[model samples]
Target chain A: SAVISQKPSRDICQRGTSLTIQCQVDSQVTMMFWYRQQPGQSLTLIATANQGSEATYESGFVIDKFPISRPNLTFSTLTVSNMSPEDSSIYLCSVGQGTEKLFFGSGTQLSVL
Target chain B: AQTVTQSQPEMSVQEAETVTLSCTYDTSESDYYLFWYKQPPSRQMILVIRQEAYKQQNATENRFSVNFQKAAKSFSLKISDSQLGDAAMYFCAYRRVNSGYALNFGKGTSLLVTP
Candidate 1:
């Protein structure tokens, strides 16, 4: 198991602005993923952040809207660009290391006004 | 594409009682994995249990256990002796074995526990 922490547990943002959420893991991990959970909906994968390369965005997601940076095995960041009311949701980061289990962060609640 | 389904939108259980949450998935692959995750009011997703498709026996974790029906493509979670902390949204997820693909999650079931 890994201890994951995210910055800005909850925040209110203005439309058209961008907010960057940071994810830091206690141990090194090979794969880190970002997900978005809309109100009353299931979680959707946003992107996968791997060190030393560009992040892989899912089919319905684009890097321009959710840019990710993975400088090392233990740290990653995701930025939500051009925030809108529709972007009001919970953004969670998860890490999969040597085991098949995945551990998640508490998530950052973002509300775009 | 793999899809997971949780039909029960909401359920309630009395304290010290047991409840089961149903989950079904559609997948063409023979080898895959299933998981149950719990999200409380704090919005922290925690792993409750996991089951591998190839495994014949069900997965169990203390008070939480899974009745895995591979032939039916169903994996259900049974919580025994429910507590207030057990009240939350429970999600079922599926992942491809040996693939680095992300998990496919179902719309969660909100469980309310009354003392």
Candidate 2:
């Protein structure tokens, strides 16, 4: 089991601003992912943050909008840039060890006005 | 690509009664895992139960259990002796074995437990 701490539990931002959410894991993990959960919708994978390499993003999501940084095995950050009201959602960080189950952070709830 | 579907958007159950939440998934991979996660009003996601595709026996945890029909690609959760605390939004997710472990989640089923 892994313990994850996500900062800025809730934040209100204006349009065109950027907000970076950080996730810190208790253990070193090889696979880390970022996800977005919109109101009344399911979770959608945003990207896979690879250590020391460019993050692999899912279709419909771009690096310019949701840039990710994986400095090491235990930490990663997701930045939502040029925010819009549509971008108001809960962002989650997840970690997995090999074939084990994925664990998620509490999530950062963002509200763009 | 894999997809999970929870057909029921909302369900109601009386306390101490039994209720089942249906989940179906589409996947080409033979080896994978299915999970049921519960998210209360607090917004913390908790793992309720899990079932491996290769396992024939259903997985049970206390009052929570799963009915896994691999051939039908259906996985349903059954909560017996349901308590008031069981009220929450439940999500069904899938992960392919040997994959990066990124989960494809269902839209979720909101359970309401009435006393």
Candidate 3:
């Protein structure tokens, strides 16, 4: 088990403003994953962040909108740029021990106004 | 492509009674991992149980267990002695062992526990 912490448990921001969510892990991990959970919907992968490299975005997602920064193995940040009402959702960060298991953070709930 | 299906949108179970949530999946890969995750109103995804494709025996975690059929591509979760804490949305997930990067999740089934 890993202790993952995420900041800004929740926030209400005006449209067009950007909000950056931070995720910190107790231990160093090779890869950290970000996911979004829309209202009444299942979780969707946003990107995979690796230290010293650009984040890999999943389908239907792009870096221009959700920029990720992984300065080191223990810290990563995701900025939701040019926010819109549709961007309102819960963002979560997870770290994997192996391909089989992933431990998740508490998640940050964002509501764009 | 691998897809996970949870047909039941909502289910209710009496407290202390046994309840089973159905889950089926389609995958071309031979080895993969199946999981049952519980998401309460808090929105934190918690792992309940997991089953390896190669394992013959079912996986059990305390009062939670799984009935896994590899050939049938079915993995159902059984929660015995259901409690109020069990009332939440249950998600079924699939991940290819050593191949896939993220967990592919189902639409989820909301469980309601009644006293």
Among these predictions, the greatest DockQ belongs to: 1
Better of 2 and 3 by lDDT: 2
Please give the TM-score that candidate 1 achieves against the real structure: 0.98
Candidate structures ordered by DockQ, highest first: 1, 2, 3
**Predicted complex 1: CAPRI docking category:** medium
DockQ, candidate 2, vs. native dimer? 0.73
Models 1 onward score TM values of 0.98, 0.96, 0.96
Query: Which residue pairs show backbone clashes in model 2?
Result: none
Cα deviation of A83, candidate 1, in Å: 1.0
lDDT: worst 10-residue window of model 1 chain A? A95-104
Task: Provide backbone clash counts, one per model.
Answer: 0, 0, 0
Instruction: Report lDDT (Cα) of residue B25, candidate 1.
Output: 97
* Ten contiguous residues minimizing lDDT sum, candidate 1 chain B: B96-105
Off by over 4 Å in 2: none
Report, to 2 decimal places, the DockQ of model 1: 0.78
Q: What's chain A's TM-score in each predicted model? A: 0.98, 0.97, 0.97
- Candidate 3 stretches greater than 4 Å from native: none
Candidate 1 residue-wise lDDT, A3-102, digit = tens: 9999989999999999999999999999999999999999999999989999999899998999999999999999999999999999999999656888
Write model 3 residue lDDT over A1-113, tens digit each, in one string: 77899998999999999999999999998779999988878888899997899998889999999999999999999999999999999999988875467888989999999
